[model samples]
Target chain A: MSTVKQAGGRPRESRVDHALAEAVRALLSEHGYASLTVDAVAARAGVSKAAIYRRYATKEEMTFAVLVHDLREEPPADTGSLRGDLTALAARIGDQIGRSAADVMTGLLADVRADAALGARFAATYLAVERSVIATLLDRAVTRGELPERPDSPVVHALLLGPLFTWPIVLGEDPDRIPKLAPVVARIVADALIAGALPPAAQDGLSGGS
Target chain B: MSTVKQAGGRPRESRVDHALAEAVRALLSEHGYASLTVDAVAARAGVSKAAIYRRYATKEEMTFAVLVHDLREEPPADTGSLRGDLTALAARIGDQIGRSAADVMTGLLADVRADAALGARFAATYLAVERSVIATLLDRAVTRGELPERPDSPVVHALLLGPLFTWPIVLGEDPDRIPKLAPVVARIVADALIAGALPPAAQDGLSGGS
Candidate 1:
């Protein structure tokens, strides 16, 4: 709230942002979201609480910013085919979202259901980004007539992420193994869409034959 | 442990089991998995701490027993086709795994990554059951020639569960809405497999075509 603008705002603000990001990542990895407090973050970053509060109103907002920022992949370059686009996008997500980011999210997911405010933030940040990535790919496919209609965005997004996201946990494999499977997972999900695997309602009356 | 059997063997065991179940459900529902304590459970259930220790070796064992016990659905009646069998099984699971089960597991999941013992327990119980159900259905399909081969059980299980399990959380829909989608979800997953959506690795070299 006070004046720190004497040194020129942009560079100083970036410096604080960098410090806060480092602190949030360290604290979240070490103690997880349950113990992340504004005070701890402030102390860890060596910044006054005012700086944190100025940037984020709550711990959820702070954690969300750092974790989700890592996932803010630029729109994948168009690859002229639905399968290619999905493969590129899924690979980018798999490559960018590291083990710590996944851990932070898994931790945050537990808290989301209990707190409506946190759930709202998660949907707006994480879910919104996933939907945008999905839209970019699906819109291109629809334009190319690869799909009769776009499937439900949420369902389609889950198809892309659910199996690949849980691959390590479910199989007890190393998380590092996911990179090899990224394109394969993308291919399967894309082929599923091409094969008419949308649930009946998701088909949205597109195919009434059933 | 000392002399509870004075009343009778079977009835006393049942009573203790019932009380422990109730206590676990209440504690998990109220405080999630992170805060569950043997002391709290024993106090709440009015059983000795030794009584709990006699039953389960650790908190993970206790939580896994109570939570996974709820999911011990009887093997679904064989419905005579892959789709029918999957639908029946999925519907049963949807009906049994209520919001609280989902919530408790979601909370436990964050910790599972951080704790290897808990991860082992989760896989032995929750994932084991899921694999068994998928195996039952897929084995039947393979026997009946509905499938060229059995797909990878873990990947197939994820296809069945990953979307439906996250439906409420991702859509922000009421958990009560899952039952309606259960059959539909089953159909889609079954169709996906039939249509050869398995990633090339999961296809197990059944099809030589690229």
Candidate 2:
């Protein structure tokens, strides 16, 4: 977690941090979030408990860091068209689905539901970052007149992601089904946009006391 | 879990069972799935550990049984039009959301993700039941010619429930919002239906090796 060690050419301090993060990811893949313990992380990483505690205040914080690291690795997709961008996003999301990510996500869902502060942090950090990416994509489409000027970004975001998110959790639905289904989902979303399902912005002067 | 005691007019066995189930629900609400133990449930229920063991084979089994009980209490939604039926279904789903149900569901997600057998059981017993309810509603719509002869029921079902399910899990979204958002979601779904977003059936001779 420190840059000084790497600058000094020692690399040991940074190695411990990387080891701890990798350990968290490995354990999450194997055991999921419920059974993960800090002590076990230290043992698996070959680091001391003090080292783990020095870096992260809580398990949730550590997990969030790992997720952020993973998120940064995903290149931003800009395909020039709303349909292409959304479909790319879907494929990116679909690529993220596997045993490990799904397991971590299932565990994260519980953590998010149980703790409000943690949930807010997740929303701000992970969810918001992704949403902004989508917003930017949609904004470009708006400039091209492919979308409304003030489309309901949040609703569109939900529509785009809801099925992908729900598929694994809901029984009998395949998480892998997203790739095949992304085009259809994107088409439906584009249709919603054209039909003006997006909420009217306040600046549109549509407000009333009704 | 046994009905024999009621037949004898003693009611002791049935009381123990009810107490155990209530204890499970309470503990689930209080501590979620990971922290709940059979011994703790026995202590909370004022029943013997052996009695608890006799009823359920494992913690997953017990939790699944509680979910099934809750599911049974939800009456099926049926209205004349597809829109009306979907809206009613959304309302019923919205009404079922609360602290306890959310807590239990959060716990179940962890369990289902961790254990394949338990996840499948949940899918089979709980998810399948709800799907059947949606299927029945959709079937009536099809009969009335409101829907095509061969519709993609799963996609329609996914569209109907995805947003509702995503809310309260993702930040800043409300489960209760589904009631208000139902019509909008149903409208998009209806549009998809007419636009033929649904995959055509194989019986229509569309299958090919291409």
Candidate 3:
């Protein structure tokens, strides 16, 4: 636990983590999440199974670390306007939806449904982290008076992200088209948030609807 | 090919088709799509694989028939008001997102990505059918003056459906909660369609953004 002792070990530990992450990504792209095993990852990464086990208790956890944690940790955008920030964020997301992204997600989600513990872990780790990032962006917009107070964060998050996520995967559109869709996506979100445009019924029912 | 001969044979043929469809649903629920085989479906339905093959060319085609064609053929909602129609439609869709729904969709989509022919068939059959239904609803709204002319159908589709599709599967939320979310979902779509609210830049760019 000593600082000097930890300094030498920390670098090696993180290096192993990186290798394991890379291994997971490679396996996911190649054979998908269902076929990805810890032993295979260890063999691929040139690390021992113990190294992967020490970090993650299950394949789901490993997937969370690689797909959600490492890949989604970019610095939050600040282009002085919410529109610019959202457009940048959208483009970044669109770029990340590589050809194999759908395969990996489809595989991961199938497993998540079958395992309750993994589902909870995903909600806690992946969903929570992603939601927090969006929350931070929305908070900045509110502070700038560019968005109304108490915008329905969950609704906003879903609307902004759902289309981008669905376009390539479910609709089978080109992933490259996401950048072109970004401006429109951003506009839709901004309009919903800024204008009190909820239908009469939902306006009363939802906190963010108004 | 005679009318009397066809009448004598049609009932039995339809009966076999129903059995095959039922068997496919059972297998999909029990073992998922990846593990499901033509042989297993044949055995479960007590029909020959050749009989299945006679009607459908492949397992993907059979899956498309049962999951997409049969289950999705509800009469279009005609609740007078677009809000009423959307609310009813949302609730119906929300109800249908039971536990097996995601698993089935995940499996179908994975297969769709792997097989080019299957993917093309899906776009032609399932995706085309769903889009036309939404388009009809939107057209009704436009006719009613509840929405503007020439709304971007695909964007509107994504926005309205993205949340409903995503919340239960990705976020691991309760499927039942989608009904509660429907009114809000409907309002968001309706607002985006009616008000022409758009971010300044995208307003100038997109057709309906302004």
lDDT of 1 at B87: 91
Model 2 clash tally, residue pairs: 0
Q: After superposition, how far is residue B12 of candidate 2 from its true place, in Å?
A: 11
Q: For each candidate, report its DockQ versus the true two-chain complex.
A: 0.30, 0.34, 0.37
Kindly report which residue stretches of model 2 are placed more than 4 angstroms away from their true locations once superposed: A1-22, A29-32, A37-58, A61-77, A99-101, A201-210, B1-78, B98-103, B201-210
- For model 3, the chain A TM-score is 0.81
Superposition error at A106 for model 3 (Å): 1.5
Tens-digit per-residue lDDT, B11-73, candidate 1: 777788788888888988788777889999999999999988877767766776675543353
**TM-score of model 2 (first chain only):** 0.74
True contacts kept of each: 0.28, 0.46, 0.46
Task: For candidate 3, give the lDDT of residue A194.
Answer: 63
**Predicted chain B of candidate 1, TM-score versus the true chain B:** 0.79
B24-137 per-residue lDDT for model 3 (tens digits): 889887887778899999999999998878766678767766665532444366777666766676665555554346656666666776666777776776667667777677
Q: After superposition, how far is residue A162 of candidate 2 from its true place, in Å?
A: 1.8
- In candidate 3, which residue ranges exceed 4 Å CA deviation? A1-10, A25-35, A71-89, A98-100, A138-152, A196-210, B1-14, B27-35, B68-92, B99-101, B138-149, B197-210
TM-score on alpha carbons, each prediction? 0.78, 0.74, 0.76
**Stronger candidate by TM-score (2 vs 3):** 3
Evaluated at residue B112, the lDDT of candidate 3 is 72
How many pairs collide in each candidate, listed in order?
Answer: 0, 0, 0
